[model samples]
Structure formats: C-alpha cells, structure tokens
Target: MPEGLTDDGLAAMLVRGLRPTRVTLVEHDPRWADRFGARAAELRRVLGERARLVEHVGSTSVPGLAAKPIVDIVVGIDDPDDEQAYLPDLEAIGYDLRVRESQHRCLRAGDPDEPVNLHCYPPEHAETRKYLVFRDRLRSSPEDRERYESVKRDLAQREWRDVNFYAEAKGPVIREILARGGWTD
Candidate 1:
C-alpha cells in the first residue's frame, strides 16, 4: 500500500477476512530447487537488470525441511512503489498480485496446492535483506531448521482465519532465529 490510499480493494488485499487458508505441509521435494531456478531465470530474462535480487526464499527454499509446497521467491527492484516498472511483466507471466504493503508487493502463480509466491522490494529494503538472511541461516543450521519445522508442524494443525495469522504466530521463533543469525531490525 503506497502513500495516499484510494482503492479499498488494495487495502484489503493484505487482509481479506474472507475464507481461511488451509495450513498444509508436505515432505521436502528435491525438485523445489529446480522450480526456483527456472522461475528466477525467467524473471531475470524478462525484467533484465531490474530483477536484481531474485532469490529462492522461505521454508521451501530450505532443503530437507517440510514446508507448504509453495516456492517463495524474493525479487529486488529499483522501487517497489513503481508498479509500472515490474507489475505488468510479472502479470504477463501469470503472476497475479497477492499482497501489497507499504514497502512491498507480492505476486503469485499456480493453484493452491502448488504455488509460487513472488515478493518484491527495493534493492536495499530491510525486509528484502531479512528474507535472504533468514533463508541462509536456515539452510546452514540443521538445528535451527529443525526447530522451525517443528513449530510450523504444530501450528499447521490449528485452525486459522488465514495463512497470514499462522505467519504472525511464527513471529516469536522468527525473531529468535534472526537474533541467533546476527540479524537485528
């Protein structure tokens, strides 16, 4: 949500208060990395230099971890507020706008069972860096990775109005891991 709001639809995009998102998890699939590579490459090819920080992120990016089957990717741009710079291209490639916030915009593709979450931000945005740091930390430390997965498994069993709530519930552990990984924000 950029400054000077107008559309209530955009405001509600982050919180629909509609149907609940199913909290599902599956065993780590080896092909996830391949999917990420293809998507990243396609983004780079389409967006050229504008796609600066294309990266595989989130739980699915971590190997040997059970996750929601969605390939989450973070793509850094010159300015997330400038939708004209990247939105059209993203939508052209089948990624629909999913979440829009003050300094970020997310797009998605595929169905609920198999989806790709594309998060966008400016090159130096804090959240962009955080995603990379958290992902790398999980990748290198099996202990931390196990801890994260265990929490996700437990939380997935509980009902939620949306996946957003489930994500919020993991905030404590996320901050803890960020601390251990030398990330402070």
Candidate 2:
C-alpha cells in the first residue's frame, strides 16, 4: 500500500474476486484521443453541470507513450463522497462503480471488449493534482516519458492477479518521475 493509505483504505481499493486481464502494452494509438473525447462528451451530457471537469489522463493521454489501451479519465465533481448525486446517473449510462476511497471513487465503463477507467475526485484532491502533473510532465518531457515507458514495458511482463496490481507496482517509478518533475504531493 502507498504511504498515508490506511490498511482499510488499501483494502477498499482492491477489487476482490475480480481477476483482471494480463498486462499488455501497445504502441500509442491516436484513436485514444478521439475515444477520450467521445467519452468525455458522454459524461458531460450525463452529468450536466455536475461534471466540473473531465480530463484525459494516464498514459493514454501522453502522446507516444505505450499504454494498456484503456482510456483513463479523471472526472472532477463538487464532492466525491456524494454518490447519490452522480452515481445513479453514471450507472444508468453503463458505468460500474468499483473502488471507493476517501480521495476518489473509481468507475469502470465498457467491459472485456473495450475498457475505460473513470476516476472521480474532488477538483482539488491531491490525487487529481498528481494525475494532471504527472501527465503534463510526461507530455512535455521526452526523457521522463521514455523512462516511464521503459518501466511500464518491463513491468508488463510480470505476473499480476489483477491489473490494478500492475498499476500499484508502478507506484515507485511514478513517484520518482513525479518527484523529478517537482510534484510535491
């Protein structure tokens, strides 16, 4: 578990009994941007003004970086804990609420065929800041981008019970890159 996350919090993040697909990295696809745009539009349509900010994030958002082909999006809302305000609407639109933590709520859209990880957080959450800073840093710094891609490629070959585990394993490298990029939180 990452620092500052309590045992319960870490446990809450785990998708118990849900096995994830083996890690696979593919060359960056330009279609990812289009997909993110479409999804963001859908989210905006569904949430209306409640969707404060919808951003393309994660490796897919960084051009030329190999990723797992999942479109990772960050959706900022007024309050993450207020599920009643948005969860039902999101669920009606085919998003499955998955991980629920203090900082954010995770929802999965699509299925085995096509996957999208939608992360919901308060606009000022530290995790949200990290996502934006790390993504922007990689987008602007080729050296950091290549270093991250190298780590990801190496990690993709390792065994993982859940794909989330693969993401967790990359924590150290992510923190290293974020730190080098001058991200404090």
Candidate 3:
C-alpha cells in the first residue's frame, strides 16, 4: 500500500460511511463520457501504453441514474507494483498517488485539488476483468441495472460503521446476478 493509507481506505474514510445517494439506471451522458475520454487522453499522452486499457467504469459511466458524481476510471497495466516504471510519468501528468493496495496489487490515483478516483489494476488480475464485466452487464441490462440500483438504495438508507462493510454487504446479490448471467467463472 502507499506509505500512508491505500486509496481504498482513503475513499472509505473520505465517505465516512456515507452510502451513495441512489443507484442510477440510464444511458451515459456524452459530457461525462467525453470527460473520461479526455482524462484517458491525458493519461495516454503521459504514460503511453503504460496505461494499457484505461476505461471509464462505475456509476457515472452509466447513464440516466442518479450517482455520487464521481467518475471511476480504471487504468490497467502489466503490473502495478512496478511503480518505478509508471509513477513518475503519472505524476507528471497531474495524477497524485493517493492510495496503494499492495496486497491487492492495485493503486488509486487522483488530483488532490480536483477529485476523481482512478483505480489501477494489473491487466492479468481477475478483479480487473470482473469489474469490467460487472459494469458492462449493468450497463447493457436494465433488469440487472435496476436490481443493482435497488440494492444500492436499500443499503444507502441503512447506517454502517465501515463503508467497506456496506459494500461487502452487496456481495451476495452481485454474485447471484453474475452467476445467473453465465459469468460463473
């Protein structure tokens, strides 16, 4: 993890267990989509192919749904621990390394003054692909999107000490849907 706290921890703490306001189920907004593209463009200009498959994923990536308004971007590379190879470049491009999840082989970046969550994951990791699959599935299927949105709403209204615990609470439903969608792997 980063010398201080990993980005995941920071995010959890930042929210102070604030559950997302609501789940959204809509088409992506061209404006936000363009912002993601611009951000990816900046990353590309700086890191070249180091950020192999930079993608906009998360609630903001989905259209028409009310969200927390934070853009979640995934930047994939061969290995995240090999920071020496990409850190300096990313730093130069205006992304500050906020959290490091060494155990998870992931890192998060963002602008200190501005605000965005950029999750870094190794392309070889299952978590990386799983996130993509889940996001894609939610975006394409209204039934699944509504299902997830409903879950978010139900959970958000409840109080929880740890935000992670709240997120973990959704595991069963996520697994159930993923499994039903033929994503048993």
Candidate 4:
C-alpha cells in the first residue's frame, strides 16, 4: 500500500459493491478522443485555474488498442484529498464521487452507453504522471501495446469477482510494459 494508506483505508475507498462482473472490451473507438476532449473542456470550464492538468489516459487513449469503452481521465489538482476544493466543483458538472483513496479520488458520470471516470490527484502525484507515461508508451510502442491488448483480451473473458481483481491480474503485464516504458524523466 502507499504511504499513509493502510489496508483498511484501501478497502474503504470503494463507494459501492464489488460483486462479480465481467468487463467487455470493444474495438478501438475513434470517438473516445472526442468524448474525453469534451469532458476535459467541461472540467476546465468548471474548475478553471484549479484544474492544473486534464489528460486522457487508459486504454481508450491509445489509438488501436481495445478498451472497456469508458474514457478515463486524470485531473491534476491542488490537493486531491480536499473535497471542498474540487469534489463539489466536479459534481456540479454531473460527476459522482466513487472512490476516495489516500492521495486520490475517482468520480464517475456520463450516460450508460458511455461512462466517464475522472481520477483526481495532486499536481505532484507520481500516479498522475505514471498514468500519462503508460498511456504514451502504449501509443508509441506497438509491441508493448499488442502485448497489453492480448492480456486484456484474455482477462476480459473471465468472470471477475471484482473489477479490481481484473486490474490486479494485469499487473505483471503492466509492470513489464512500464519497465520498458521507464518511470522517470
């Protein structure tokens, strides 16, 4: 676990159930970029200067990779744990708080056909940059991208007790890609 975040703290982050469910990965959608762009614009309009950085990360951000069809965005804020600063600001624009971790928060919104997840983190958070780097690496390196896609495609076929478990299953592959991608400037 991350510093200051205990095991209990991690478990408490879930705002809802972790029932068994399967995620279906779909073909790369060209419109995901536009969807992310629109959301980023809306977030900027609402948060203004407080929105330090808004980026499109996750499988959807990669051009040819298959994904869950949800747009995952990372917003760098002054402080993620300070809900008063951005939680309501984002909620005002229709985002619902889903996860509140030690140094991060996740908000979800959008129609059922295409949901959006906003990950909020401090401007200096390593996870925020980690997301961007992983995304960029996949975008540029077809070899790693294909390898990730294969793993995701295989994992997507299994019925997961929790979506987090599915994510955990991808750890080895993600780490391999991240190793090739590097972690620092």
Candidate 5:
C-alpha cells in the first residue's frame, strides 16, 4: 500500500483502473481572474482581518497551466491550530474540514459542492508562503512554467493510489525552482 491512503485494499483495487486526464496548456484566461477576485472578496468579507494574506495560488493561479479545475486559495494567519480565531468564521463561509495533518502544521478544507481547496497555514512559516512565490515565479517565467507544466503532465499520467504522493513527486523540481528564486524551505 502506498503512503497516505487510508484503505490499502481500496488502493490495490483502484490502481489498475485509474488513469489521469490528458494535459492541456492554455493561454491565460480572464475568467479565472474574475473568479478568484470574486472568491477573495467573499473570503475577506467573512474572515474579515483574519483573512491575512489571502492569495490565489496553485496551478489555476498560474496562467496557461493544465489543472484539475479546482481553485486553490491560501489563507495565512498568525496561528493555524487556534480554531477559535478563524475556524468558526471559515465554517460559516461553508468550508468543511476535510483533512487535518498537524505534522505539516497545515490543514485542508474542502467545499464538496464547489471545487475549492482551502489551505490554512501560519504566517510565520516561509514554506507555507512558498506556494505563492512559486505561483508568481511560474506566472512570470515562461521557461519555468513550461518545465513545471511538463512535470505535472507526466506525473498526472502515472498510477497513484494517494494524491499526496503525486504532490510529493513534484517536490524536487519545485525545490529547484525555489532555489533559483532565492527561496529556502
């Protein structure tokens, strides 16, 4: 059984049948910009000042990258574990706590009705903000963006029981780009 999957039997059962969607590289879409802007506004309205450093990060944030069509938003705060400070407000906004991996000092919320991934992290953690930096880097650098797109395309084609493993597979290239961008994580 691969790491991170709760059901080893399920993983074994699905491996033979799983296949990834084909990759598509598109020009920057204006609609993505509009969707992000609207969602950010809503997030700020609900979380108020606690919505610190809300950013549109992930493949969708980067122009011309093939993605799973989910909008990834990063919510940075003073403390991620302190539920009293932000969790209630976020829950009010309709985000469900789908996963909590304190080992990573992070938690993931999901909106099953809507395709969105809300990642909560502490502001003090630089690695947490690296996602934003990476998005920016790819948006501005065509070379880096192309490389990342290629890596993503290849990785997506592989059979993986756990989504986390697919994410981890991109670590090396991501770290290399971060190093080039003078970011240490």
Candidate 6:
C-alpha cells in the first residue's frame, strides 16, 4: 500500500507475510540481554566462521530505554548477498528471510507471539558500523538515551499500520543522536 509499490508487488509482499502490527513500548527488561546472548549463540553455532561478527543493536540493547519487546541483532557475514552460503543454516535455525536488499538481509525468528529481527550485513558495511556505533552511543550516553526514549514514547501513542512505520518515524531523532555522537554516514 505504500507509494512506489505496485499492486502486484504489494500482493506478493503480503503473501510473503504481514509484519506484526502491535507497536507497544515497554520498560527495559534485563532479560533482553540474555535473549540476545542466546540468539547470538545459536547464530554462531549455526553459521560458525561465516558469522564474522554478531552484535546486539537497536533500542532493546540499550539499558533503561523503552522499546518494543523484540530483540534486534546484527550479524556480519562475508557476503550478505550470497544467500546460498548462509540462508539454509539460518532457516534451519528458525530465521525466515523477510527483507532481502542489495547490501543486507533482514530475517525474522519466532512467530507473531515473540519475534526477533536478525539483520545480516557484510563485514565493513557502513550500516553495520552505524548500528554498532549507535548502540554503543546510546548505551554510554544517558542524555541521548533519554531523548530516544522520549521520542519512542511519543511515537508509541499514535496508530501505525505496520510496526516498522513507527521505527522509520524515529529515524530523524536517531540520526540527530548519531550526529551528536560524531557518527557519519
């Protein structure tokens, strides 16, 4: 339904599966760290050396920040575009490839009840560095973390057709915080 996506393309995407719509923000949970560690271990076990680097990114990784319950993780591989090399192993471990882009692949684990976002990017990708730096910046800076949490709380009050839309809406603030932290695109 979004602009630039034709009816056929929209239908195909819908057929693939609709993303969960609930966008509730909850207080930071210490268990999120454990969840990330568990998922990281599984990814490492499955991909072995192919998983060049695995890290916990996004708001969930930041302590004391309100965020959607889903755990966000970034997995760096040799080549993200080469699905043949890692897709099967990831799929075997319950990750369903959802968004396949030129530079990255966004995979999902678990059903609508409990979900995880596994972002796969090639090593040295700017997005990978951005995710790491943004996460670290948020974790280390209380002022930025509070600002992000305020933005998220305000956004959570509105209605969203898809949960991802809410995430996209936070981009400007995220970029501002990243800039304050000296993160360049």
Clashes of each: 1, 0, 6, 0, 0, 0
Among residues 3 or more apart in sequence or in different chains, the pairs in candidate 3 whose N, CA or C atoms overlap within 3 Å are 7-99, 24-65, 25-65, 26-63, 27-63, 28-63
Candidate 2 lDDT, tens digit per residue, 12-66? 6765534645788999999999999999999999999989899999999999999
Q: In model 6, where is the ten-residue run with the lowest total lDDT?
A: 1-10
TM-score each candidate.
0.90, 0.90, 0.74, 0.92, 0.78, 0.88
Q: Please list the Cα RMSD from the true structure of every candidate, rounded to 1 decimal place.
A: 3.9, 2.3, 5.5, 2.6, 5.4, 3.0
Best candidate, TM-score? 4
22: Cα error in model 6, Å: 3.9
Clash count (model 3, backbone only): 6
- Estimate, for each residue in 73-121, the C-alpha lDDT of model 5 and write its tens digit: 8877767767787777777766666445441232334453336777777
Residues 1-185 of candidate 4: C-alpha lDDT, one tens digit per residue: 14343335546777874556798999999999999999999999999999999999999999999999899999998888889987887888789988877788888999999899999988778888788889989999999999999999999989976666787788779878887889754
lDDT (tens digit, per residue) of candidate 1 on 3-73: 23334543486633335666889999989999899998899999999988898999989989999999999
Kindly indicate the candidate among 1 and 6 with the higher TM-score: 1
Ranking by lDDT: 4, 2, 1, 6, 5, 3
Q: Which portions of model 4 miss their true places by more than 4 Å?
A: 1-10
Worst 10 residues of 2 by lDDT: 1-10
Q: Give the higher-TM-score candidate: 4 or 5.
A: 4
Better of 3 and 5 by TM-score: 5
lDDT of 4 at 49: 90
Cα displacement (angstroms), candidate 2, residue 104, comes to 1.1
Give stretches of model 5 more than 4 Å off.
1-29, 103-114
Candidate 3 TM-score, true structure as reference:
0.74
